[model samples]
Target: MTPFLEFDLRMIIVDRLEKSYGGRTALKGISFRVHRGEVLGLLGPNGAGKTTTMKILTGLIPATGGRASVAGFDVHEQSLEVRRRIGYLPEHPPLYREMTVRGFLRFVAELRGVPRSKRSAKVDRAIEQCGLAEVAGRIVGRLSKGYRQRVGLAQAIVHDPEVLILDEPTVGLDPKQIVDIRSLVKGFGGERTVILSTHILPEVTMTCQRVVIITRGSIVAEDSIANLTGRGEMGERMAITVARDLDGVASTLAGIPGVIGVDRAPGEPPTYHVSVERGFSGKELLSAAVVQSGCGLLEMKTVPETLEDVFLDLITEEHGVAA
Candidate 1:
């Protein structure tokens, strides 16, 4: 596919973005893109330039250097147009305590340029879409945290913007509320593009199609969730419980052509979690080695690869290199 179609005219594009606070740099020339119709997870630990990038993308702040464009408009030159095409939910949901959910939504629609005739209909749609119907008449300030968050989401989408930028969308939420918010985000599916920033790895796995991991104010890795997690041939990990001794088990497995590393889990009759190198299938070799060693393989199955592993590995490996 052409680059335009591949990235859908670049829903979010940042080239060598740089920012500094006083003399200390907060961003060191970071750059990445979010494609249309895809939920791209922007992941990093605290101080990783995630929020800084989001702020720049949403026109909250100006970049010290480099270029940015969202929804086909240059962020610097076309800030207003860019804002008009995007929806944003900052870490702190902007809300008015005295305004009911319905009132706040109508105000947001109007601010987004919705016509008077269509404002009510738009507000109603957003309320329903975000599951705010039951709480629509309640004052936003008096609503539960989850309901308030839902109202924030509703306001972001009230104008039907082409792109949605959410920072820490699931932060400070209970398990049930997190699930609800993720479900609401998933409902955005193909109709709008999503650029979500969060430290939560599982959230990225559940809601995002691709991931862009940043660290030290720089882009570290970017790829589809499948590629990042080794859903392809490379990402398979196995946990082996052997009835044999733990001694040298890690080394023996490490010697296998496809085995990456073997770490002993803390316990008796030690079990080891083995990660296979990318593009290597070590299952058969593992079985053979267990059989040859006269060790009974207690259990072995394909465990789903986690974004946490990839995130930690990348960040740790980067630090190791810098050190």
Candidate 2:
């Protein structure tokens, strides 16, 4: 008997995209592809062309040169169709202040081409999904920033597009609102392709499936969150507390084949935090060596690499090179 197989489609495709403003290059031939059912994070410091790239992809602005497609439609040729298939949540979401929440969403639903008969149902569904039912009748201008943000999100999803391009979705919201919005974003990860641009590092770590790191208008790294911060890219950090003097530990660990650097941490008994140089498993090697050595290896622990570390490492390297 044969088994059935399913494959996800490609959501966004960009190649050799270039954009310039007043002779200043914003995106220097940037390129990347995002797969369907995955949240791709557009991460970079300020002025790294994240906005430029997003604008080009969403058909908000034309690229100076190169090609892109959204949901199998060419951005240059079939922009309207592309727009219909994608929902864009810009950094500063455009909202009509004078309209009530329900009225605003109904207007947006109509604007996005929802069928006349289904517009009400669509609006109701969007409001419910975005947790806007209580504030549905209130004027948008009177709503809080967090509620307004949800209104922005509601408008974006009113048409039930296949792709969602979110720029700083959690901006200006309280911690609770941020968590709520992030949870909603994560819910769409395996159903629709999400292109999320955010400065919040934890949001990316928590919600995104893949991360694209850009620096100086170019892609410096692109990989899954797990692989990007895994033991290979960032060597494991092992902390060992022992009852001994802090002499020659750095050099001794550095002498080990895969050990990179060892630094003495300030504490009562003294501890050495070691960085594994190569991609070897530090847990087994460190435990075995510590047992064999005469030093009383009181405690040893491994610190997992996080997205924050990866982001810091990338930007620090860029700054170092620039300097």
Candidate 3:
């Protein structure tokens, strides 16, 4: 097996993928992989080549250079095979406004080459899965934006493709609609590989198993969300509230093995933020040290780093700006 396939049966592969519009390059030799049953978030700012990458992967547009493959078939060489194995929802879903929700889905099923015997079942399944049962009989033009987005999603899945590529799926949704759509996308995990291209950081945190951050037409970082947010690092900061002398508590915590330093939190009485050294996983030792020093441990919790922090730091670094 090739090295890439040896890794984990990659469902999608982009090898030095590049795209250009006239003289301007939209993708600068980017490369990544999406493994079976994994939700990989493609995050980037506006005009950052995110949409371009999605288009290339979905075979909506041909790449200027390099190669891509879906389900082991070349996207450009075996386009039909690739399309048959993948479902695509563009940023603007191509919906026939005059068609009823059920009608649109049935049309999509036929376009996707679903067998006549299975078309009805497939259309029904898509409508139910996307929560469009109530709106199923309504005209597409009369439905709300959220329901329209659901119809788009239903059509994409009508053929039951193995890979689902959604571009800004919840772009125009309300808060509740966004939440509902997120739940639906999360449900696709472990059954279908998904490439979710969006600018919403929280959506990635809630739905994606791994993230690929691109900037200025190139990939800047690719890793699991935890690792990207520094959660995987051995060095950690934990907040602890104790009912004792702040000086004594700080001193005691600093003395614990692996406890590097302790500082009083600004304007917070009896609470100290403890910094643990790298390679240390000694929360228990710190707790024991606190109690032994006559400091009552009221509460102790680790401070988690957010994805927004990571995203900004990376984007800043890519632009050579001091963060």
Who wins the lDDT comparison? 3
**TM-score of each prediction:** 0.89, 0.91, 0.80
C-alpha lDDT (0 to 100) for residue 144 of candidate 1: 89
Pairs with steric clashes in candidate 3:
none
For residues 1-323, could you state the per-residue lDDT of candidate 1 as single tens digits? 11222235568888899998789787889778777787888999988999999899888899999888887678878788888899999988999989999999999999999999999999999998889999999899999888888888888999999999998888888899999999888778688999989998989989998889998888888998888886533456778888876466678788998776777878867578887865666678887887676667787766677778778888997889779
What TM-score does candidate 3 reach?
0.80
Q: Tens digit of lDDT per residue, candidate 2, span 1-323?
A: 11111223777888888888888888888788899888999998878888888888789999988888887777878788788888888888789999999999999989999999999999999999999999999999999999999999999888888899998899899999999999999998788889998777888898898899887777878899988888356578888888776456556666777787788888768788888854566567677666566567899987787888888888888779879
Candidate 1 colliding pairs? 230-235
Give per-residue CA lDDT, model 3, range 1-323, as digits (tens).
12223334798999999999999999999999999999999998888898998888878899998998888878887778788888989999889999999998999999999999999999999999999988899999998999999998898889999999999999999999999999999999899999998898999999999999998899988999888888534367788888776356677678888887788986644788887876678888888877877868889998765788678867888889422
- TM-score head-to-head 2 vs 3, winner: 2
Q: Cα lDDT of model 3 overall?
A: 0.87
